[model samples]
Target: MVRKLVSVAITCCFVGSVVAEADIKNLLEMDLDEILKVNVATGTSNAISEAPSIVSVITQEDIKAMGATTLAEAVEQIPGLHVSNSVNRLTSLFGIRGIRNNNTPNVLVLIDGVNIAEITALSVPYAFRYPVNFIKRIELIRGPGSAVYGADAFSGVINIITQSPSDLAGTSAGVNVGSFEYSEAWINSQFSVDDLSVALSITRQRKGNDSERVTQYGVLQRDGEFDNIHVNATYHELTFNGWYWRSEQEMGSGAGIIGNDIDRDISETISAQLRWVTDIDKFTRFETDASYTNHKLDGLFQLFPEGTWPVGDDGNLFLPPLLL
Candidate 1:
């Protein structure tokens, strides 16, 4: 099913890119597609072209252009990744080479080298509730990285690389409003004082599928509004570095019709990390990362007495004929 058939959905979700052409003239002048073709000279020895595996590098500029709210959404740009919208709000299912279905753990998710996929559920929560605007870039390796990343690296690997203090050396902000009253806002900045460098960012956004009302199976229903807030701060340099990230999300349809209230879901995560990098000599350097993360999920569903509901699967409901 994954081989002979190919489906590509190119939806242009607009993002405000009105940066004065002169502000970033250097970047604006360069052809991003061409630049991406070159291999990265710095960082780990494994360059894009040199690696023995398929790797797609997605830059912040690409992310901005796509207006993607999550990592899974951004990776759709890769050639082999097929898109599938799962029924579960908390999970996303995608595969390459016909390797994915309702159950697949071949993809390993990493954020700054830290594995983020849930152990029990076998998937990373990629819903809009997560903070992805803070991402600087993403690297998807369509092969085994288990030699270095350990298990969960069999099918592929996803690296969510966030911005460094130097990347946000100045204040920057963006807000977008699109069809369906979807709105997003983000602000980021960096401060430097002698030997210390600091980066801070905050983002908030909301989107709903049914801006008015939606009928499913003849039942009048409304999609719940989804909202999220994220905050992060980082201090880094040669000797030592530290960072903290926190985010919260909530979704609920405000008191549904017939008083059969819709369920509410809330999720939150907090993370902190400390790292030390030491250069022992001209040819050798050592670095280590110590980190901690805590996540919480809450779901609230309403129960109604049997036979007390009038709404049908076809969205057809019978109300006492309005007395004129």
Candidate 2:
């Protein structure tokens, strides 16, 4: 079964590429033959004619046309996928095919073939954390991908490919503001020097309130701030990628989990990768890659005090004070 699945995935690559060039309007007009020629690379490197599973590709053009600002928003456009909130409302969740979890650990997310899922937590790292500015395209494969991508690819896989120097050609900057005291600014630049291509992007965002109305504990005013930096460079078959992201969010009562508690949650992620690829023969290829990733969490939550209290039949024994 695995071999057959692999063979089918190989065939879909070629077909995916053909359909990629067609606009949404033209796509409906294309004949079945043209539709079968659409090419995709998420399943395998080979361009097979048949696909073993469902795959959805969102190009950069589609992103711009939809005015999507974050990766989560872009993904929400895909069928059978929805953006959900974690129990504590601290993380964004990707719920696919009605399957939901606290961390959305059933899904696998990657950037240019590099895994970005948090190692210890085994979940999507900082959901909606990635800005769409540098993304050239996104390929999402729904269903089990363990045969090709190993464990944690249980429900789906999302592959994000960043733009190259040729894609940007110059520099750009933008800022936006919205309700709830939301504001963001970003700058990106791409250029070529000699044989090397480089692209860099930086973004910062702040939101004074999450817009969630507290019914019982009153309004705690959940707030969040984020900063991200991305860099990519390629020289011939050798490529390098770097990403750094930090976020701080004020946890507002945690959806009544800890009632009226005021605390903060902070997280940071750093990742870098170096890869070299070479063609060995007409039908053979060789590639090597090295990557490093780190995720850190500094959180404060209010819980019951450490000391214990005596229990009495009256149920009014001395109660310990809340601890931070």
Candidate 3:
């Protein structure tokens, strides 16, 4: 697969007449052992481990090197993990260590110490999903953490910490435009007033693709748009700190040639939390956190008879004669 990726990358550059950016020295200087040596679980109240349990941390620097735009893309590089991008933009199935269970939520995902797993279904939804630009670090701890954190932490725990006031103390903003007329813009700024710290951010993204032919049985839709606005507040101290965030997204779909229907989905999330940490003694400390998130989804579809419309939307039709 690596060879195939390399070949594709080479062919892309050759056909497009574009220059690729890479650090040959950094590639040669990379050490697998050293890269995996970083400790992560110690910072939290979770159980301790004698030996690393297939753990790894992808730093912001590492995320930049990969030039990936999605969390799934960044996580696919982890050993023993497979990320499957399904038809639904709000669905992603991941497997780890040969545990390929489709109907179970074996993997747990936490953002800023809060569990973001979907409760209505068994897996995580990609609609209100977190983005990479807002990420600070991704910590993966393989094996079961259910005993310490609770259910859904079976396969492992993926903790993604978004950029905080401390991480983005200065000012940073950029715009990117590329193929398919795809475009994106983002801003990360911080402010300080006395002991209180605050940060604000906004992002927008859109793209159009016509790579796949539309069909009734197959995935007839292949385009999407996303926009998000975020804010962070913090009261920095040795004993306590707190923060909160909210975002919204919309995904568009194209109808097959048979029908003139347009399907689109809209979703939003509002999350808030409070956390307090206090030291009981020299070597021990107690921590507590509470949070809540409200998420919703709305989709519009079409209705047609059997075989009448090769590619028709899913609209319930009952008591047709009376209702019509």
lDDT of all the models against the reference? Answer: 0.55, 0.70, 0.57
Please give each candidate's TM-score: 0.68, 0.77, 0.70
lDDT tens string, model 1, 88-118?
A: 4435666765667653477777666555554
- The model with the greater TM-score, 2 or 3, is 2
Better of 1 and 3 by TM-score: 3
Instruction: Please state every model's RMSD to the true fold in angstroms.
Output: 12.4, 8.5, 14.3
Write one digit per residue (lDDT tens) for candidate 3, span 1-324.
000000000101111122325676345435643334333353332222333456777877888899877677788889888876444543566778866465338888767655655554355544533457877778887777676567787887787767767768677888877776577888788888898777777777765654464334444344566666666667753212222323233232322222434445554445555665555565555555556655555544443435533332565333324323
Q: Top model by lDDT, which number?
A: 2
lDDT of 3: 0.57
- What's the true lDDT of residue 314 in model 3? 62
Write the number of the candidate with greater TM-score, choosing between 1 and 2: 2
Give me the runs in candidate 1 sitting further than 4 Å from their true place.
1-45, 67-69, 126-132, 211-262, 303-324
Candidate 3's displacement at residue 198, Å, is: 1.3
Best by TM-score: 2
